[model samples]
Target: MINTSTMVAPWWQQAQLGIFVHWTPASVPGWAPPYDPAGRAHLGWTSYGEWYENSLRFPGSPVSAHHRETYGSRPYTEFGGDFADALSGWDPAEWARRFRAAGARYAVLVTKHHDGYCLWPSEVRNPHRPGWHTPRDVVGEFAEAVRAEGLRFGVYYSGGLDWTFQPRPIATAADTVAAVPRGAYPAYADAQLRELIRRYHPDILWNDIAWPAGRAAIRNLVEYYRFTVPHGVVNDRLYPYTPLWRALRLPGLRAAYNSWERRTVVSDEGFVPKKPPYYDFRTPEYSHYTGPDPFEITRGVDHSFGYNRNSGDDSFIGRDALAALLGTVRSDGGNLLLNVGPRGEDATIPPEQQRRLDWLGEAAGVGSAP
Candidate 1:
């Protein structure tokens, strides 16, 4: 729980469009189920490249099937090495330039996803899984590049789910909530966030999943808002941990998280008792509703947020649609945080995603190339 008394909206609230970069080893295989078996894939369950590790854990999920067929009985840990090697060819400067050209006011890179693979050179060790972090300083390099382009830099850390920290297979929403690590996981997230704040001082601290419910988590969130980060913003997902998700009421997790059951409500963006504020801004993923809330609608042009080699030819937005999406978001008094999952091998934005971004830049009168 951050000390909300000191919290204020960062420039991002009005700056509008921010680009979310979800590049991990998952980009290596680049596949997700495309649709949520539970329901309402559009609101939340489209595609997420960061879930590669978890996908591999399931015995029958598409990701698991794909992994077995492609990699064959190999452990998922091998992809960490592969992903690190792929980092050698990454071009941060070019990425920053293109992000600027895409009219991004801020950029959030996934410093660590549920896989427990850290992008930056973190001294924090994964006690659950040894040798799980990267030796390269991806966060520092990328942050510097983005800031140099005048775009505010942000970090997305998965405090709720870490497959390496909790390696059980999960097939349902309840199973998903049950598997989140608690013991030392919160400490790990705290240390990494402190490291990110001390080193990069990211403008946004985007957390996915609720934070571990404990003293340390509260302390860290308070310290982050009070001291380490200035002008920093947090997302709605930073909630006190609820073991077994009592907050979501047993089996209503999907419904609470924006299934058709709760249409107007944004999932997991609940207020505390009678607390007035929800967040500095609201986050509605994969939809373009003309709402009145101060919000940021994040969605991938394709079905998945990460690069999906298997996303099929029709799974992307064209230049016209991209421009229209931006227009709708802006006209609705909301920000559009578009997402791009770069190929891990070359750290390149797929041509389809980039083409639309180029058009968005031109439409916003930011770039001439489109």
Candidate 2:
């Protein structure tokens, strides 16, 4: 455990604010990403991400219909077309400027989602990879840009791949009777993970889905931390039993000091109860995928953290909502990690979001970080 006195306060305490930015291949398609028909339908297509692997499993579900409409008989493996020209015009520096103006002290970028597309080039197991990869190391650029603005950088990685690939068992139904042979793909997982750590040196690593359970995963985590940053933080999403992992596996782990924010929809019920010492950080109280209601709280005058092409009103969070969210989260002794979805090209935050955040900066007294 890192000594609090000798150690700096976890970034959450110091930052008091963060930004959750979800950029994926789905972000490129400009269409609703695919979904798991066998699961919840309201989650929308991309909510479960690249569910084509499970499309056959569900057979003729709404998801399949939507996929057919979107791709027109094209196989799911062809989803790379979405990213074909998506980031070609992306500019990370401009993205950093908006985040900085929004008063974010740190930012979390999704390096890879369940779609299995890598934002940063990797030498690990490829997931339906293409001949031409993302022209630039998007993840690397994001980290550099965010840091240039003097914010700690974070990487959000999905642990489980959507079962749309050759090694298909990770996609097995939750209640499947047959146990799929769990291959030792730790090399692939570890390779990408290690590369991220070594290359960008992110301050926080936020993982989703299963935490890559096993001793070897723990070892890789330890080795990475010891070598890259002695004071970096890792989330508990990797462990089933927290206390054991907290004691045995975690040495430099942030002390119940969640530096990274959990991305999810917040409900009107106010604070979501978390396990003791598990900080939810900057998660939104509600999800846009759930559809809008009057009681729904959006960050700005525009009712979203990102640019919602489907929104008729073009919601942008205003000063009142921003202040309310900050006060509420701080009162609960938590940090807020707001989200922003930039346009696919030029990495520009929608003008509406920019205007509101600008107003917020001037009005909310977000002022200097003193």
lDDT of 2 by residue, 256-322 (tens): 2222212232234222222212212223344321211111122323333223443343233456766
TM-score between candidate 2 and the true structure: 0.68
Best by TM-score: 1
CA lDDT scores, all candidates in order? 0.72, 0.51
**TM-score of candidate 1 on Cα atoms, chains taken together:** 0.85
What is the lDDT, from 0 to 100, of the residue 79 in candidate 1?
77
Model 2 scores worst on lDDT over the 10 consecutive residues at 289-298
Regions of candidate 1 where Cα sits further than 4 Å from its true position = 1-7, 36-46, 214-216, 244-278, 288-293, 368-370
What tens-digit string does per-residue lDDT give for candidate 1 at 57-135? 6575677777788889888788788889888888899999999987888899999887888898788777877777778
If scored against the real structure, what TM-score would every candidate get?
0.85, 0.68
